[model samples]
Target: MRFIKRLIIGFVMVIILGICLYCYARLIEPNMLLKKSYSVTVPKDVKELKIVFFTDTHFGKYYPQEKITRLVDFINEQKPDVVIFGGDLIDSYNRDQELVNIEELSKSLKKIKASYGKIAVYGNHDYGGGAEPIYEKVMTDGGFKILRDSELTLSDLNLSIIGYDDYLLGSVDPNRYQLPDAPFRIVVTHEPDVIDNIKANGSLLVLAGHSHGGQVTIPFMKGVLRPGAEKYIKGQYDLKETITGCDATMIVSEGIGMTLKPFRFLNPPNIVVVSLKHK
Candidate 1:
């Protein structure tokens, strides 16, 4: 009888400890930022451009306005030449919780300074729960140009940026936009799965954010898989090789917010800074 009682007590303690750890990871750890830098060749002859990219600010239940303000401040401090937002600006999934203050969020985001310009794309969460228009409005109001299945060229610098829509929600067709002859060409999308379908004639770099790094990763165990992000979870990958006569690379950000159960373990939020140079 005494041994059985001890076993039950131990089980109860374990459960309690698990609960505490989960809470810390979901709430406290979500606010922590993991900043990383990378250097890539973009085929341009101009000076190196510093690009700061981040995404998935699910601004509702767990994430709030203050977090975004702080994030904007941090990005500004980086003095990025071009700022890219990967998408999912609003957490409109939870019907129980009130929506994030879109106006305030837009105001906060507008403070971010990028010398070249600020570009944005949409994620699956932005389209989920019928919040697409609201999210778009917020981004536009904040001075972010929404790029959807389109291409923008910086004529002066000989750089071209193509924006592919979300894989599930918007158009994922890479065939629509032809790769320009610019020395530097980039593709920005919300889903990293599109990297598989990209057919490029020149050196191309694609940036995306949707997986949130599985949002909850455990050692030796797989993280939660979302629909479109089942393949690329986090970090960078080489989609094509020069050995194959083509060069392309893709970067999938872990993102800054959470969804569904609101928990993250081992996978913290990320702010990626990439420097582009001539090959």
Candidate 2:
């Protein structure tokens, strides 16, 4: 009799603990935002630059558009010289159209001030769910220049920013166009795994967001990794031996929103701020 009673109590305790974890993952963790920072060495002649990168705000059923206001404020506080968005802006444009207010979203995005410019690249989600038609417009409306398999040169800084198309849904050919003889280069993509395919020479820094740092991470076991984010889950990776064959560093942001499961465990949403200084 006592053994059965103890078993029942243990079962009840397990059930209660599960409920508490569920609530924390679904409610508390997802709402928390963290700011992560890193520093990179550039040529001494090049001017110092501060770049703020954020991405994967699914912004549909799980993430609200209003949060962008707070995000913009947070980014502005950093006073970044260049602002780069890694993509996955809207979760599902088809289903979330009603939930997102275009004008408000654009206004908030515009308010995010960056002296150099705001650049963006496409994510798988941006090309999927009927978002292609309006993704460019939305981002452009918000003062972002979309780089699809293209390169942008910042003459004064002697820097080149190359953005590739979504690896899964869009076309990506980093070598399609010849990059200028810029001393510093920054590559932005939605998926970090694609970095191995990039062949940029010289000092390089890559920024990506898609894994969400295993949105629902567990203590001992691995967290969920999306299709394109299999190899590089999150955080920084020194890719000196990568296919790029150049000395390079990559920083993958955990991102600012939730997706498929609508829950965030050990990993909280985050924006990455990178400082580029003379070597």
Candidate 3:
């Protein structure tokens, strides 16, 4: 009887510890590198456009410069015509005092060349990083164009990338980009759940983060629970044809780094680089 009791207690302790570890990895000290290959068909005139998007980097207090520099280097090697960084660029707990060197990371990212130019949006972590002021400085000074509930068009690529503000805080403007009667319209956002209501309306593709793919998913099943995960979370899925009948693809990234946790299980950090190929 005594031995059985001890075994039960040990099992319970392990379970508790596992949960704690997952929480940290998912929310606290998670360091991840995620890479995926996606090819989509656009008009032959599209000329194989590639875009590298970095999301939820949460660089603050713990994560450092060398790590981000390596990521930036990899992005350059991809040679994307345009680069998009989904926000949370800085992570801080002081609520007032900023942590990490975002300027350096921004400078590194600025080195990534794209004919169309780089763009980005805000995440919940961006809110923690002093929202507008700090985030604006990091990107604009670091050579990135921060889009606060606005739209920017790339005439050369014949593509339009729409940027939406932070999803967590609510009250973001969704402005329409005057797309040049093209076959594809791309939109960039920090969170995935928001797209649930967005259907495929006038857009060919939607890119988002904030799910972190549960930061650690087990085998043979979906994530135990994804943060802010709507019906579609992690990986690529269809948003369904709207009553208006729009054809848009939704790609949700597992993203890099952890906001509240610091551990990753089956899920690793990653960057989504997809080519607009001839399908």
Model 3 Cα lDDT, one tens digit per residue, 1-279: 999999999999999998987676666445546478777667665557888887877666545556877787778788888788887766663542445655566677677777778887888777764555667777887678877777777777667677877767745754433233446677787877766555344437778888777766667767656445655568887654531355667788877776554566666788899888766
Model 2 C-alpha lDDT per residue in residues 148-245, reported as the tens digit of each score:
99889888888888898999999876575344444678889899998766665677888999999899999986699888888998899999887454
Candidate 1 per-residue lDDT, tens place, 177-243, comes to: 4554444478898888766665557577789888888888878875997777888888888877531
Residue 100 in candidate 2 has what lDDT? 84
Candidate 2, overall lDDT?
A: 0.88
Which one is best on TM-score?
2
Better of 2 and 3 by TM-score: 2
Model 3: residues with Cα > 4 Å off, grouped in runs: 1-32, 45-47, 93-99, 174-182, 199-203, 220-227, 242-244
Where model 1 places Cα greater than 4 Å from the true spot, the runs are 1-13, 93-97, 177-182, 241-244
TM-score of each: 0.89, 0.95, 0.80
Q: Who wins the lDDT comparison?
A: 2
* Cα-based lDDT at residue 116, candidate 2: 89
